[model samples]
Target: MRIYLDNAATTPLNREVFLAMEPYFFENFGNPSSAHHHGRGAKVAIAQARGIIADLLNASPDNIVFTSGGSEADNTAILSGIRSNGIKLAITSAFEHHAVLHTLQALEKNGEIRIVYLQHDAQGNLSLPHLEKLLSTNERAFVSVMHGNNEIGNLNDIEAIAQVCKRYQAVFHSDTVQSMGQYRYDTRRLNADFLVGSAHKFHGPKGIGFLYRNAGQALYPLIYGGAQEQKQRAGTENVTGIVGLAKALEISYRNQEVTRQHLLRLKERLIFKLRDRIADVDFNGNSANTGQSLNSVLSVSVPDPNTGISLISYLDQHQISVSGGSACNSHSGAASHVLSALDTPFGRATVRFSFSRYNTAEEIDYAVEKLAKCYAKPGVSAYAEGLLL
Candidate 1:
């Protein structure tokens, strides 16, 4: 039996979401921009979907601008939110996803703005006091902070961060891609200038997401051409994907409590079993802290730094799929920047096992059994230790 514990990378398409999107792919298909009967129907579907999503987040439909995915939404929020406001300074943490981190780096490379990286502890908790200090010290700045760490599963206190930014009168943007469907977000109460969501992260269709631009943000278009997305994003609307996204988010909210309990149980079970079965097993960041981190994600560390990739390969061979870090950087063949930034110990190998509603207790037990066996093998642990000596 193949067990997939990589929900953080992307989830399988939800059945209900697929059904909602089916009509758009066939009989009801039409370009939403057109004015004929066929086009009007498609346009209605898109608008309804937008309304559903907006209602769920307590955001205005006009504020939700569709994008290709989280990366695009992040880029849009960072570049447009910065340039359109005439801001020249930014603040973020090293734990941010590449989407936000790389975008700020590029801006700095072009001599467009200065970036102030907020201090973080080894457990990946960012300093909010430091954030306040930075904001007070700098001019009006664009602040990009993620709602959750994709690799370490650290949940940043974005609400607190948003409050600080508001006090400083700075623009705040959060990459909520990981925590979108998992957590409840009322944009009005949160008072963030921008927030982003990706459908694939929440069992919706891939290649579809949205940017929540607060009213009167005056953000310009990242893509230019058509009048789609209320002249903010310029491309033909992704009607099918939009329908899927709305349906998926609706289902997520309707069943949010049950899903939360299920995921938390699975995460706790995996943590307990791994600790009981493996010697010196540890968790990175606040992932082990149920109260602070994402219940869907857990980053496990074993006492063998050299075995990060090797252990992932072993698990794959045993029909258990997991990841050493973010799937986005898996092919880079370099150490995880998040782990590196935290100065993760040299003798520990890390693996991120993310859960979904589909994962079962039996699968958790099976994965732990395989991991225990891998460590039990002669020279598997000893060999790595020998190399360190």
Candidate 2:
């Protein structure tokens, strides 16, 4: 079986979620906006799913607005939060997901708002003091920071950052796409104005996600021409996907502790195996620091840039799958913006192996074994000799 270690990109849909979504596909398929019985049934299903999600998040049902996925939710939060609030200044980190960075950059280009990127240390940890300093000087700025780094697995102290934003009266939005299913977030206590989740990231169906806009926060619709999402978003809801997302999130929260423990074991095993088997292997960002990183992700850096470039394809040949960093950057082969922001060494190759509850210790060992072979000295392995055809 192929060792699938790219859960950060997406996860296999859970059987339970699939089953919960089955009826919605055909049996109950109807436009949620319709006024007939079929429409009411579909609308009720959406409401129940919304309630399940909101309750799980300890948030009010009205605060949750469903979108196509995390990208859409992120776009809605940044654009609406900034525009509706009339915020002219913004702060974000250099390594935020493109959804946030690019959107803000577009606004900056249009001269709608000026943005300041918060600096970070060599470890990829954002400087909260600098964030506070910027917020203090700016006039009611919008701040977008993520709870977890999708590429490097650095977990930011968003709660503390939220407090700082509160002190400066700045609107804070955190892209929690990577952190959502794995961690418990009580929106009532999070102190942020906006947060995002993508169903596909946590074993739910793709094409669905939710945006949590705290009570009293003003955000205009990202989509127009319909009353869906209480008019916060417009379109016919994806009933099947919505049902699956709710089911998937429920399963994730129910098994979160068990899943976390299992993933931690797998991650630690891989980290130990990689360090012991490779000569010049290291890690990027805070990925290797369990206390400060996502438990499911480990970003390994090999000394040889050539190996870094070829290791993934070599592993693929051996029935192992991994990534250089974010799947969004996998095709480009460009150095990850996250790693670049940290000034990672120029000659090293970085591989990100993300874990899930489905992963096993054997798969971890197998992946590392093949990984070490890829690093073999020049004549010892074909890949090491730059001989792969």
Candidate 3:
């Protein structure tokens, strides 16, 4: 039985999304910028897709700007928000993905942006008091925090944070890539200046995502070229990818409750099975406060350090796909910054099993069974000790 438990990394493209994108690749291959019939048809499709995305986020189509993916969307928001507003201080958490972390680091090194790192509590929630203190010190700042952490699946109090930003008159941006399809976000209610999401994370095709910029907030374009994306972003659009994203978003929104409940059930089942069958296993994220998190991701750590990598390998060998950390940082063999920020034991064995609507209870059972066997292997404990030594 093959089980895919890495939906947080990327989900398989839904058939509906694929079908929606089919005609764009061959039948309607006109640039949206063209005024001809073919161009007009493509433009209509693009507009419709934008409308669909807008409806999903409860925003006007004019507020959405498509990009290559979440990384580009993040870069655009961070660079543009700071540059346009001339805000020297950027407040973000140390747990952010490399996309945000590295971007802020580069800007700081260049003396283009000053950054303040927000502290995370033991549960991975942002420390509001710390954030308020930082904001009080620097009145002119842009705060960027993620909606849901990709590794641990910890959800931040974005609404509260937005209120803090409002009090401080700072621009607030959120990387909602992980929570876009999983959670309900009404842009009007969230009150964030900028939000970013990637298509691939929501069972859509790769190479496309969008940044929702609230009206009246200007951002400098990272990619300068032909006027595309209403001058806020440039370069030719990914027609097929955009269509796929819209279809995916439509499905997600239409079936949000059903999918959310299904994923939560699977997550609970998996956690129960792990706890009932395995020893020395601890859940890493705020499982008790799941209402604030994406119920699909379950980050767990084994007390035995050596078993971490071996367990991942064993799961792979058993055709049960999981993640040691974010796929972007998996190759580096580094401990997760998210976990580290929460003061989770570093250099310990950890695995994140993220679910999707398509996952089933049977698959969870099989994964737990395989994990139990792997953890019980002879010398596995010794191997774990060696790593610490």
Candidate 4:
């Protein structure tokens, strides 16, 4: 069936978004940096796209700064925000994407800042009191928490978290890459200083995304020298990608409710089948909770951890693709930071099966059948319940 269940890593580009970008790539190809007619046209197109994105979040076009993708946007937000605001301490969770974690780590390594991790329960819920304590004692702190956990699909209460951050006057930056298109965001009430989005995370083209900086926030330019991005980001803009992103985001918002409801059904079906077909099967974090977890993600824990790679390969051989962690971090064969933070059962394999609007019930059935077959293979009885690692 060749089913793709890894939308969290990146989604296939939407046809409408592709068509929207075609004109910009050829007949309308012009450097937005130039001051000619063609350049002016491209500039206007970019401005229109920016306005659409800003409108989606109830933000101003002036607050949107386009970037390569979520990673770049996260990097720019963290470094620039800290430098410009004299933020010396940061609050984050152990399960945060490395985009935010690594940046904070580097800064802390160089004595640029101090980091405190928020307390989280086994189900990946944060302790609000812990956040309140950390925020209360820290001055000019940078808080980097994602809207949803990429590995485990636990959705955070950004609004509640934002309230605490506001009380402490902390600069809050959320990596909204995973939740941008799937959920609605109203910057008018989000109470955040910065939010980031990546087009590829939705159904838009790769290599383009944006950072939403509140009007009053001061962020230094991570990239040096260029009048582009209103002097915020350097280098020429990616006009085509920017257009596709805008179009894709528009489509996502338009179809968000229906798509979300449909994918939620697929997830529920997969969960039911996983339990029915496999022995001692379990899920990580809030992935099994439709109301709390992301509607598109399901992180399954099988009995055998040593066969993690084999299972993925076996599924690939059957033309069904899934993941063990974020595409960026899974190849290292190390446990996912998110799962590790939740203290997932020792030696149990974790397979993340994420979905998008394109997936179907038939594909979900086939994936479950293949997964059960993979675990039932001969001579691996050590995976039996009593022998669990």
Best by lDDT: 1
lDDT of each candidate versus the true structure: 0.90, 0.89, 0.85, 0.88
Runs in model 4 with CA error above 4 Å?
305-309, 377-389
Error of 4 at 97 (Å): 0.5
TM-score, candidate 2, is 0.97
**Cα error of candidate 1 at position 360, Å:** 0.4
Q: What is the TM-score of each candidate against the true structure?
A: 0.96, 0.97, 0.94, 0.95
Worst 10 residues of 4 by lDDT: 380-389
On lDDT, the stronger of 2 and 4 is 2
Alpha-carbon RMSD, each predicted model: 2.7, 1.7, 3.0, 3.0
| Decoy 3 TM-score against native | 0.94
Q: Count the clashes in each prediction.
A: 0, 0, 1, 0
Query: What lDDT does model 4 reach?
Result: 0.88
Q: 127 in model 4: Cα distance from truth in Å?
A: 0.8
Model 2 CA lDDT for position 213: 94
* Model 3 clashing residue pairs (backbone): 306-384
Best by TM-score: 2
Candidate 1 lDDT (Cα, 0 to 1): 0.90
- 1 against 4, candidate with superior lDDT: 1
> What does candidate 3's lDDT look like per residue over 79-118, in tens digits?
8888889888999988787889999899999999888888
For model 3, give the RMSD to the true fold: 3.0
